[model samples]
Target: MNEAKIFSYGSIPRKGDRAKAYLYFKEWVGRFFEFDGARKEDDVVRVVLLASLNNGYVEGSAKLLDLCGQTVRNHLRYQDPSSFLQVNHELVDRMKRLGALSKPLTLAIDWHDEMYYGDPEAEGVAGTRRRRGSHYAYRFATASVLLDGERLTLAATPIVNEPVIDHVKKLLTQVSELGVKVKLLLFDRGYYSVDLIRYLNSLEAAVCNTAAVSHKGVEGRRG
Candidate 1:
């Protein structure tokens, strides 16, 4: 295992509760991520952990990790896509281990658009008419299990000109691959369509979706 060396605390109080909490979080992430090749897995995890804790950028991560900004950027730039996918799958499995998929699944499916202001040549960039932040954006369709007082994201896929129904089908297929039995599915008004309802019915999952009401006096409708 090419694990990266754990960060040294130096003069930081090792016995402090905050230090222990950080260690616990790092160890939990380490359990899910396993990098291949000569890359230091520890360093990779450290960079990600720092970025997540800070401004979610390499520069902030480098500041916390005490490494050069380019070094942090290179660590991410050189990552193999296949390895990243493996890590994602492993993380999903870890979520299951934490009882995220223990009961019959009731998923909330939705689309998230991230405003993008970068170069036009970037891949996966698309135009969005839904918001004013940026005309161009990246979209992702996510399926999350509705847990007790929280939602656990089960799967997310990039959306690039794919039909919404087809993307929902693919998301469901990925959730099924995780061995979760779908009991119900909830979606916003944007996903209200007879075809989508029929598809969920075909899978024996009850569908609850907000209908697009063109008139008043219609409420609490279920299909």
Candidate 2:
């Protein structure tokens, strides 16, 4: 039998013949968890246990539905080499109906200044002093346009401290596989970077409608 990975938060089972090592991934801490079989590497076997933490803290064990099992599935399929990914707009619509998602597929490299809560009457309803509001660095890819001028989309979680390069890489990898094509990417003056532009170009994606005044040559033109 293939070695299996046992997942838990605190410690390994004491009575088991061998201890299974389960590490907590930064993305999935408390929301959902699963056991995956081990893979052979040289002379040893290694297994990965993934978990998604709930948005807010609770007294006891999280309810089964509180965890994002589909998120876990997406994560696993993404890691597989032979798998193909597709982002369906219909699926996104269904998620919206279920109130699991909101829309506006923009990526934010910086932090926002707003407060999020499960209850409107909760004590701290105003903006927090500790953290800014949530923003999207990268979100979903879809066959159909998910966001319209009247619609605003949102990310599942706030993306902070992540470089644009890494975000771009992940977006290109997953979105392309999902058959979602973006004709142009528009951004403000703050995102202007020669390195980022060049990288996007390498992937055959153009960086359109970026502020041009930062260049010395452009400055001369204003005169």
Candidate 3:
């Protein structure tokens, strides 16, 4: 049998003890394995036992097992995530791996804007009328959840107009270089234009958007 050896030393009694220790080590290796990125905490000691009967090692088995599988499972998820999921399923795994590696998610793209208030009192005191109050109107571009279910601020910019498609595409290209994939988008109707829709489709981005009625296509130009 193919076996790997590990040496452990301590003040021990006899040759028989060494044999028993090897048997225990071999049995442990044969029976179980740890996942590559999983972790267990001491918080569950009241409900679960983590100490080895032979040795006083303290660790949660299930958590270790899960971590062992995390790396492979995340890789698989990134390769082929089901489209119906609202969040970028693949992105989560990548984030987990990044966390395991002690890296942080760095923001990319020019995300302009400071607040997302529709009330007039909240508008900036002195500002450009084209965008008026905030840095820029959130609806002017395509928007997606950078990190969802968290308290989101309006300081982030969205995919605003078809005219800026090249700019947005370049930003996405930069993000992909960091090994994270952008898959889903969320935005408002004002960002809608034929070109923008086509661009989003080209990126294979499943988008959630508010619909805009184009005046050019309706009766009397459908105003």
Candidate 4:
């Protein structure tokens, strides 16, 4: 008997396959967002998604998406803030539909400090102290859901000289508008304050936080 012959072939994904996939993705994104700009919607979505997936740099996204860097930069540079907020609101709605707000959920609020080496007088710049010590930084307060071993950011607001309690109240109000009932809030020591606790209590949400060491020491002395 003649020996049986066997053949194997390796198939690489075609560029057309990638293009088709991107088209489908763009269609889904379009269902939730509508870009109103000089750049084509497809191109805008491609650049924004690609840039997000690639460390948020236009040059890297352009190289990966086979577009000119300057073109990607222009699209981003000219993107309207209102359009971006509309898109974000749509995403948040979708997230709520995914059962993110179906029930009372534990929420975590914190401040993210981004170091800025630029001039201290720059607009939107504020002084913040981090592990690297005091520096001019842009601070943003973020509220996130702690669900099923994952944290999903729900809202973020710039914190330029705003009190932490006020920022938290604003975030809670925005989250409430999304129909989410916050069951509890977890905060860091930096956010520990009687006024903040009272505010959260007024919202009928349980609150937990790490007591600042200095506060603890003062209380100990008073005792």
Q: Pick by TM-score: which candidate is best?
A: 1
Of the pair 2 and 4, which is ahead by TM-score? 4
Candidate ordering by lDDT (highest first): 1, 4, 3, 2
**Tens digit per residue, CA lDDT, model 2, 116-212:** 5345444424323433443211222211223533222222222334564564455445444433334444433434578666765565323234212
* lDDT values for all models: 0.64, 0.34, 0.35, 0.61
Decoy 1 TM-score against native:
0.66
- TM-scores of the candidates are 0.66, 0.31, 0.28, 0.64
Residues 2-110 of candidate 1 have per-residue lDDT tens digits of 2232334444574664555466457766645544553566776777776755436766676777767775566566656566556557666765776767767667777
Scanning candidate 2 in windows of ten residues, the lowest lDDT window is 41-50
Stretches > 4 Å off in candidate 2: 1-161, 205-223
* Candidate 4, superposed: residue stretches over 4 Å from native: 1-27, 30-44, 51-74, 98-100, 130-134, 204-223
If ranked by TM-score, best first, what sequence of candidates would result?
A: 1, 4, 2, 3
Lowest lDDT 10-residue stretch of candidate 3:
214-223
RMSD, candidate 4, Å: 11.0
All candidates: CA RMSD in angstroms?
A: 7.3, 16.9, 20.3, 11.0
Clash number by candidate, in order: 1, 13, 13, 0
